[model samples]
Target: MKTIFFSFLFFGSLISAQNSLSFQAQLPSINLWTKIPDGPGPGGENIVSAKGSVTHVSIPKLIIHQPENPNGIAVLVISGGGYAHIESGSEGYPASEWLKSLGITAFELQYRLPEEGWATRSVPFQDAQRALRIIRKAAGKYKIDPNKIGVLGFSAGGHLAGYISSTFNTAYYKPQDDIDLISAQPNFTAMIYPVVSMLPPNNTTHSFKSLLGKDSDEKDQAKLSVEKQVNAQTPVTFLAQSEDDPISPVENSILMYQALKDHKIPAELHLFQSGGHGWGMGKKGTNTGEWTDLFLKWLKVNGIYNSDQ
Candidate 1:
């Protein structure tokens, strides 16, 4: 029974919008079934890459980015690291910065890696669900609409976002407090080149192995294949992937979009000709750079964002 305490992150690079890291705190009172796992995983104990990704995480934290003119919209941004690490540097921070500029309050989630060692497969899922409820519980404090909360994830994180978006009704963990009473569901979801499936050739082996472990059964994998889990209550979704994505096949996004449509949920998909994958917010001359603009428009069209607000 090891308890984790809050340790605020104050790095300028990790903060979005001119040092606007309004809040960076651990999800309060997490009750994992077992003690939190310490890292000695792929990149060695808690070593962060030059690219800003950390190879190990014992405690998950939520970094808040407040917009200069908040339009009552919020997004929980999850970065991808193939379930091996947390890609806060590339995927998380940059996306939060962009979201902040657009007046959308962003919360960057640094979640635990299952492969690093956790008692259960649902550890990261629990972190995400708790993070959303925490935000919703304090919706008035952030001056954002609770019902407008959405999630945006990249790569493996996209799989996580898709997971919670579709299966939020499932209780992955016991309630810690009144915050747990708030809905963990996202109003919308945006998955960028995500690893959506856990079955067959389309599944990314690294993510599958990290999530379900090497000796995982077919039944367990089938249950986590997000496309197979979509129901009538799945949130409106937006998916973007490069046609030539080498890691997560483009079919991942396609399958998710089809599931959403099958359930009569509003959905959108964008396929780029180039840009091989993990392009984060994209650089100068890539088609993936245009995804943010497209996403903003979709949010507005879906009534999740209001320029007037």
Candidate 2:
């Protein structure tokens, strides 16, 4: 295992009080391409919201949030935006903050938008896979257990987390460095209101169109759907969603849970009576708001986390 010590000064402009590192800035470079690879047509990234929702991302980044008391566990956080943009503020940052309370290090992913002009629709997957490898490769530096790294994603980002968890063995991009040699497979996965299927009754049209393109065929949809892609190697998973979620239907989570169980993968599902969708970290007064506690308990029960450590 190689140890990497980053010079935070070089990224002074990019780093806030919290650390932010671009994929392009990795020490040995685990970037997918030499530059932002072009897509079928013309376009560029843009920030669209005060909450830091962005589209057409050219520089995929990881925002690091370290706990004051390290517990040797880490989680890669991916926010959802239906593949159109990243909901970093609502999902990513808050998730990281919550994880920090447990002494778990968090790396919030600002992944590329497939809706942008990427050379392939798999660009987001490539970024996600690379991010996991980077986290594992830097385990020593971050004081994290390489084997304890997991992923938490919301909505479309949940689909992405599911994709990476189920398909980690598949190379989404050519190896770029030694980091690529590290396993991209997450130790476990947690998805909230994920867009799991591309077929009817559960298909999230916006996320589907953003990822597979407007002209994507049914075959393409079926092939890449996260639920359909689950295998024996898929990571143990924890899924939570609301029965009343108007956006990405509740059936999406059900389909994924079913697939995991069929493959004999250890999985947990939490269904809320209400809470709708996109309630990142959830609201404070509702039962859904207690999901963080539920997740922590689940982690301990699964032996994936040990607070006593």
Candidate 3:
């Protein structure tokens, strides 16, 4: 029963913007089972997304970036770390900055990484559910349209966003408060080169091992394969993946798109020729740098973003 209080993050003018709703983080009121077979031994930064990324995480926090001119659109942005750490600087703040420039409010959620002694397979989702519930309850303060709330996740986080969007109806924990009554469902979801399946061959072994142990049964893995979990009510999805992504196969996005298409769910897929994997908003010359523009256009096309709001 350890509790950790959150510390507010101030990134100064370079990373700060207007009209944000950064909530104070609290320890996990509800604990999910965990299997941390490997201990955190002298954790440090690992170069990822062309930036120094933290390698271990425990508590969850929200760092919001509101647009200078809000369009009543908000996206909860989740960073990817293969369930090992959070690329908060490269994947979290940078994305929020770009979204803010688009007049779309962005909430960067720092969720607990699996296999970190704080969570099991369901822990990340529980934290996501709680984060969304808080946003939905305080929608007005953030000046967002609750129904227009969406999720954008990078890599493993992308998998999480898609997984939560489809499985929002399943309750894995008891409600905590009035805010818990709010649904965690996203109106739209975006997965950027995500590890979408728990099944091997197409998915990353580390992420599945972190969430579900190496000894987990086939049925459990099948249950978490997001492509097979989509239903008629699943939200519209936007996927972006590099054809040559070394870590996560392009087939993950393809399988998810096919599932959405078969279920008649609105979906969009982008497969770049290069860009490799985990380029975080791209590294200049890469064509993946243009993904933000395409995402904005998609949002506008879906009427999720409007200048008039």
Candidate 4:
């Protein structure tokens, strides 16, 4: 019996290694759809006619940098391109590589967009939830610790990540296969220039309307604003934004941080005076790029970086 167990373990390890190698090779070729466009935008007061989709899909590219020592920390990275496209190079790859260098496994999620239907809010959210479950289901194979999983997103992706963190308990779609058994809650979240407010004062951020749909009325708006839904159970969040960001204002992160604090959830807000929006990983010598270092330190202070556990 002992010999059979040992043989199984050895074979499993070999198989996992082979699979990882194959995945690495194929990562470059994986073309995941950000969203399938529905038609033109929904022109109206406060609502802008933007590209949208019905069935948004995500293709996660897993990169393992520090393969020798797995830190148990896994980050699901979401890139920002409003709700129209995904900035893969600037936001996705660079951010993932940074996490990988820190011994943390990274999964770059190319979530669905809002170009399909105006009334559909479930697509992108569902994709995020599915991605989390898929990662957790294959945690052992990926050499990732299931409990230490977290999420990071930029711009619209930031909203997606925040939504996932808040709505882990809300089931929008049926589970697929056994992977559905895992919870979708992100242990922690890091949002960069996220769009947290969608109502009147933040009408300029049409990304929310594009995602949720044009018909998303006041009630729906109230429901989707993650800042309003934050609770004690909300994951610890680290947020950063520039004051001069034209796409997403600094108030977005500020509102989220305030909500988190109100709920007594551990939260950190780093508002840089410069570094206008969409500077993924930031340019060299810029304050935005410095956010990564600050995030790492915050993680350490919060005890999330402890590898011993």
Candidate 5:
């Protein structure tokens, strides 16, 4: 009887230790705040009734999931909330848990939102880059492979992921942290219903204007379009979108796939006839949930998924 009691205690302690380790491996929290100016007036000649600024607003709530295999591959996840708020359920937790089940480590990134500032277009972009560097720095300790690290983003977060894929070499800000020296480029990118264009002829996404602080000019607009940025060196990409998505048009993925093809980059696009937007892992029998299987297939074909099984 004593032996059995000790055995139960040992197993219980082991489980508790594992849970503690998991929590410690996630993204660290940072200070963030928004400041609004004091005033009261009706607009007729001159009035700035409400003006605000975001200060000490650092990226927080990054959560990491370490895989059982301890292989080198890791994926950073960026959740989407229309650049306004983060959808923790659809865009964050479910995806992270699924990646863990597949023996793939995951990180959930919570970047700054538009309520912070409109004049600054590079803050959130810089945050994405920094997150990658942090992963690389702790590669060995976290059992992650630096070379196999990738990124996945949804909706507006997809736009940020797309930006990182294209401008990996661009230095947006000075590196201050220990992880700064590592490259920000993801080995591959998985974008779901991403917004790919902001230029005229296709200028429809208002989120871009709000983030950029002003409507993009011809040159700047062209620069923001990820479709035009694909190259031979760009990471392997997998794109999925619903044909009926009202917020992000399906054409965005189509155009990006064509660009990837032009550069001979490994790319796969899956467009469902009807899934609408933000179905997130999807409801029962919905098409969006099946995307996970398709993504895994792509990973296996690319040699990213280990075949030790």
Candidate 6:
């Protein structure tokens, strides 16, 4: 296993003290694509959204969110933008805050979009694996337990969390550094309104198309449809989605839950009536508002809640 050593400042540190600590690096073995452009995001209140979301990703950024009392648990947070843009505001910063409140550190991952002339589908996954290696390798310095590293993904990011958890053994790129020697498997995963399948008849077309390309063959599509990829080794999972999610169907979570059960992996699923798709944490009067509550309960059961700290 390649062991790459690096450091990033903890979140909440003074701006002057932390600026130099930000860690943004390209994945190991970025062979051909050297130059990438940084495009503007669809700016909003506290959120950054890249219009069309297909811009090239030069480097993956890991923005840390450190907890006041570290309990050895950490989460790699991934935001969704339908494979085009990243929902950093809605999913990244807010997610880190929540995770911190639970005494768990969070690293917001700014991953590559497939449209940037990358593999069109594989770049995101490859980057994700690399991100896992970086976080796990630096866990000790970050006051985290390498074994407690988990993934929490929103929407398209959710699909990535599931995919990486299920397929960490498959090598998409050659080893780059010492970090490559570490396992990329997340100890646990939480997928929110994720895209579980890439195959036709149940696929989130826009996401799949952006990922696999419109001209890609069905066989390739089937290979990435994560629900079918689950094996006995997939980690325990937590999933939540509204039944009325207009974009990705609720069936995505259902199919995944069933697969986990078949494999005898610990799993939990929550479906809400309101909070249409992409609501993040739901607004007032939505049953989905309690999704995190359910998640924390499950986490406690699985010994990930970190109440001892």
TM-score of each: 0.85, 0.86, 0.82, 0.79, 0.79, 0.82
CA-lDDT, candidates in order: 0.78, 0.78, 0.72, 0.70, 0.68, 0.73
Q: For candidate 4, write residues 1-309 as lDDT tens digits.
A: 343333333433343344333433445332222332222324221111111111233332233333446687888888777777666555665577667767887887755555743345466776688778877876887788788899999998898889889998887666546766778888999999898887667756768757656676778787878798898778999999998888888888899999999999999999888878877776433566677778888888878886353
| Of 1 and 3, the candidate ranking higher by lDDT | 1
Off by over 4 Å in 2: 1-48
Residue 265 lDDT (model 2): 97
Model 1 global lDDT (CA atoms, 0 to 1): 0.78
Per-residue CA lDDT of model 3 for 1-309, tens digit only, reads: 011000112231222342112311211222211321123423342222323354544435566676667777888888888877776665676777667777788887766666655524576787777777777776898688899999999988988899899999888667756767888899999999988888767645467777887677778888988898999989999999999988888889999999999999999999999887776776444677667767877887888876354
Q: After superposition, how far is residue 70 of candidate 2 from its true place, in Å?
A: 1.3
Summarize candidate 2's per-residue lDDT along 242-266 as a digit string, tens digits. Answer: 9998999888999999999999999
Superposed on all Cα atoms, the candidates' RMSDs to the truth, in angstroms, are 7.7, 7.4, 8.5, 11.3, 10.4, 8.6
Clashes of 6: 11
Instruction: State the displacement of the C-alpha of residue 24, model 1, in Å, after optimal TM-score superposition.
Output: 7.7
Report, for all candidates in order, the number of backbone clashes: 0, 1, 0, 13, 2, 11
Colliding residue pairs in candidate 5: 27-62, 72-145
Query: Which ten residues in a row are the worst by lDDT in model 3?
Result: 1-10
lDDT of 6 by residue, 147-230 (tens): 899999989999999999999988967776677888999999999999888876766556887777667688888888888999
Q: What's the lDDT for residue 89 in model 4?
A: 51
Candidate 6 local lDDT, residue 156: 92
| Candidate 2 vs candidate 3, lDDT winner | 2
